[model samples]
Target: MFVAAALALLATMILTIVRALSGPTLYDRLLAANSFGTKIVLFIAVYGFLAGRPDFLDIALVYTLINFVGTVAVLKFYEYDDSVGGDYQEDDY
Candidate 1:
């Protein structure tokens, strides 16, 4: 049953990948990536549980935080890029 759940998650993950790949706009792609990141974190937790690796959950939680931060950063960067016409007008950091 655990493996069955994993397979279902994998199927949904594939759909998310397709959404990310074919997104028509930056926001759409960002959303898809964010969703994928969230799913990945869950997948890690479930798989780790099934494999009896309790410690792996700590790493998964850490990566979940990273994924959230990364998604925000990517969205902010894209917004800045769009607003500035892809020019380096703002602070260079």
Candidate 2:
């Protein structure tokens, strides 16, 4: 049933969180976070259906996209910093 699926995804989300926290490297943590975000989108969609709320799906979709973009941006920042051999700090001046 949908409840069972939702529970399964919830477990996966928890696992992903652990992975993100205990990851050995930056890439590993990022991968875990990305996977968590993806699982969250699935969770929200299913939850919305079970609760008879279709509008939630739209929000989930937007969140998913934003999560993906944010992850990519963070990863890029890290990668750039690594290549530059220094931590990045922006100056608004």
Predicted model with the maximum lDDT: 2
lDDT of 1 by residue, 9-66 (tens): 7888998899999976555677888889888888888898778776688888998899
For model 1 the TM-score comes to 0.80
User: For residues 1-93, could you state the per-residue lDDT of candidate 2 as single tens digits?
Assistant: 889989999999989999999987666788998999899899999998878886888889898889989998997787666664243335511
Q: Clashing residue pairs in candidate 1, if any?
A: none
On the 0 to 100 scale, the lDDT of residue 43 in model 2 is 92
The Cα local distance difference test for each model comes to 0.79, 0.83
Candidate 2 clash total? Answer: 0
